[model samples]
Target: MHILKKGLVILFGSILLSIGINFFLVPFELLDGGIIGVGLIIKYLTGMKPGLAIIFLSIPIFALAWFYNKSYFYNSLFGMLFSSFVIDLLSFSRGYIQLQIPPVVSSVFGGIFVGLGIGIMLRYETSTGGTDLLAQFLSKIFKINVGIMIFIIDALVICLGGLLISKESFFLSSLTITVVALFTSLCTWNDERTKLKTS
Candidate 1:
């Protein structure tokens, strides 16, 4: 029962994230960081499917997770898979999701939705793989916070994306991803505090 609930949470969360990416971000040529960011770069540069690129790029990160943290591997495996699938499924709607809102609105709201999805997955002890796995590993070894590591990694990716995309989109995408990371950190903080208090 618990597994079923977790699966559903991940599934729904991934779907929302997919919608945010395909419906909002991709339409505007906006990018986020991590594997998804790279996938967007590939899609823009090579005309390949972003979802396919995401799955391929995430393999190494997932393998790292599998070797280092068994629990993380088990939890995140399905979340990554489901997210990849959902992203691909939503790809058909690319550039077609009309909204009355402005580009900035899309960036803010899209980041929020993506962050919420990621946070829910984390709440269940699962993940969406990609640089998130790398961030966790780095945090443990370097005595940095995972959220900070994630922000740095994502920032780097956004910079690279800026080179590939327009400056305005790059800045907006960076802003969006900043909010996404912030929201994720906020969501996970209470859990960490609770654990610390209990311990």
Candidate 2:
């Protein structure tokens, strides 16, 4: 039952992520951070599929997880692959759905959806791997807050995307990631509360 529930959550989260990326972010050439941002940069530059790029880029990260954290490897493997497949499957939606909203609005909504997806999966003890897994590994070693580590990695990715894409992409993606962080924090806020209550 627990496994089934987690699978469902992954499915739902992947769908939300797909919607954010395909219908919202991709339309405006906006970006999120982590491997997603790197994937988007590759997509924008080489016309490669972002999902495929994500999978390819995650190889090294997954290799690290396999050796250092077998549990993380198992937890995130399906989430990453399924989410990537869903993103590719939904890529056609970009051509069909016209949001007709301001770019800022789109960016905000995109962040909301993406953040919610990531947060929900994380709350369930699963994730789409990539830099999220990397951040987790690093945080354990360095005794840093995972959130802070993630933020730094995300900021670097956003900056890289902006440099490769455009200044507008930089500024707007910064907004998008800020909103993403806010919503992700909101969703995962229960963790702190639970810890406090138990203490």
TM-score on alpha carbons, each prediction: 0.92, 0.93
lDDT tens per residue, model 1, 71-168: 87888878888898898888876646577778888888888878777777776777788887677678668856566677889999999999878898
Error of 1 at 104 (Å): 1.6
lDDT (tens digit, per residue) of candidate 2 on 1-199:
9999999999999999888888888888999999998999999999999999999999999999999889999999999999999999999866777889988888999988998888888778788999978876786678554555666788999999988999988888888888777776676677745755786
Q: Count clashes in each candidate, considering only residues at least 3 apart in sequence or on different chains.
A: 0, 0
Q: Which segments of model 1 are wrong by more than 4 Å? A: 141-145
Per TM-score, the best of the predicted structures is 2
Give candidate 2's total backbone clashes: 0
